[model samples]
Target: MILCCGEALVDMIPVDLPAGGKAYAPHAGGAVFNTAIALGRLGVETGMVSGVSTDTFGRMLASQLEENGVSTAYLARSGRLTTLALVHIENGGATYSFYDENSAGRSLTFADMPALGDEVSALYFGGISLVAEPAADAYASLLAKERANRVVMIDPNIRPGFISAEHTYRDRLDRMIGQSDIIKVSDEDLDWLIEGEETIEIKAAAMRGRGPAIVVVTKGAEGATAFFGDASVGVAAPVTHVVDTVGAGDTFNAGFLAGLNDKGCLSKDALGSVSDDVIHHALSLGATVAAVTVSRAGANPPWASEINR
Candidate 1:
């Protein structure tokens, strides 16, 4: 089982009403939550670990996870309001206006953690949950506790607005990234992490030096590359019709992990010595899965039956 640790919230997407005005439609979202949903849909045994509300949106999130075959037994329930992101779409890209003050997902603490079973083989971490308050620290602590024998993956999925302080957030992020066995970062995040690394290879190596066994860099339309030691493998993005680019990264993360899982590469020992062929396959799988999401309106990932995985 793979345990995804982060925020679970509702995304309020703008939509046209038949009556002539536009309104917001609630959808289950949040980077880590989306990854968990996609993994479950991809036929991976997965579970979500986070703080969620008992509110309408929270209930919806829980239902979506279960419906997608993601376990919600690790959820920390509260009476607090749910975090909401008002999505603004323009030219097929999406932006968010968050309403997370004092929300359930942002209020998680170390005490809320659940005991992990030996069935768990790997763990994934990322998203706004890493920028949110006490929850960020809580998630970090959980990672430190369970990363000893488990393979760990992380995608910063950085949202600049959520970061309250640059230095502190970077420090926290670096700590987590250094502990991760594999990490996927957007080109934008790469630039932000290292200002002097002229080439992607240099930046990837710099990140790999920080501790991760494998470092993957994703360029929006260009593609993604994975670096390990002195070797690197890459794949191009699949051509697909335009739709709102909401959950592309999350879906890609799930697909990549799923591909690795299929190859029995979810163990720390396997990842430490992963081959180029394995990396290439995982990258291709991720891009293909993300292509399916790009063809849809929301952050909807494809099921295993759809891809015949």
Candidate 2:
């Protein structure tokens, strides 16, 4: 099973009302949550670890996960209010205004973390949970505990606005990256991490040197590339009508991991020795999944049947 650890929250998406004004519609979201849902929908054995409220919105989030076949056994239940992200769409792009203060997802501590069993093969980590206070520290601690036992995949999915302190968040993220087997980052994230001191490729190489056997750089619309050692392979994005790119990156992460898992290349040794063909296949799967997500209204990912078709 692949375990995803991070925040689970509700997104208040802007929607047109029947009357005249627009209102926010609640949708189950959060980077890690979306990835877990996508992985489950793709027929991957998946589970989630996070603090979820007993509130209505939290129930909605839990129901979405269960409906998609994601295990909820690791969810830490709490009476704290659910985190909410108000999404504003302009020109097909979405921006968020978060209300996460003292929310359930952000309230998790080291004590709230669960013990992992042998059934878990790979662990996925990223999103705002990497930056959020107590939860961030909790996740970092969990990563340290489990890094030696499982294959680790991380995507920073950086949101500059959410970061309270640049130095601290960077230090924490750098430490997590060192413990990861595979790391995925967007072009924007790369630029920010490396501060444009050198070329993107050079920066990626530096990141690979840190620890990750495979480093993937995603260029939205253009394509994505995976780097291992001195070899790299790039795959073009699949063609699809644009609706919204809410969950495209998260879905891509799930697809990439799912493909690797299917090929039995999810371990440190296997990933380190992975071939160009295998890398290409994973990137293709990721692009395919992202295409389905971008063609949807929200963060809705396709099921296994859709992918098989």
Q: State the displacement of the C-alpha of residue 280, model 2, in Å, after optimal TM-score superposition.
A: 0.9
Candidate 1 lDDT: 0.92
Screening candidate 2 with a backbone cut-off below 3 angstroms (N, C-alpha, C), the clashing residue pairs are: none
For each candidate, give its TM-score against the true structure.
Answer: 0.98, 0.98
Give candidate 2's whole-model lDDT: 0.93
What tens-digit string does per-residue lDDT give for candidate 2 at 1-309? 999999899999989988989998899999999999999999999999999999999999999899999999999999999999999888877878899999999999999999888899999999999997899999999999999979999999999988889899999999999999999999999998888569778999999989999999999999999999679999999888999999999999999999898789988779768988888889999999999999989999999899852
Model 2 root mean square deviation, Cα atoms = 1.0
Pairs that collide in candidate 1 are none
Q: Where does candidate 2 have its weakest 10-residue lDDT segment?
A: 192-201
Whole-model Cα lDDT of every candidate shown, in order: 0.92, 0.93
At residue 36, candidate 2 shows an lDDT of 100
Summarize candidate 1's per-residue lDDT along 1-309 as a digit string, tens digits. 999999899999999999998999999999999999999999999999999999988899999999999999999999999999999999999889899999999999999989999989999999999996799999899999998989999998988887888787899999999889999999998998888749998888889989999998989889899999668999999888968789999999999999999899999889878999899889988998999999999999999988846
- Candidate 1 residue runs with Cα over 4 Å from true position: none
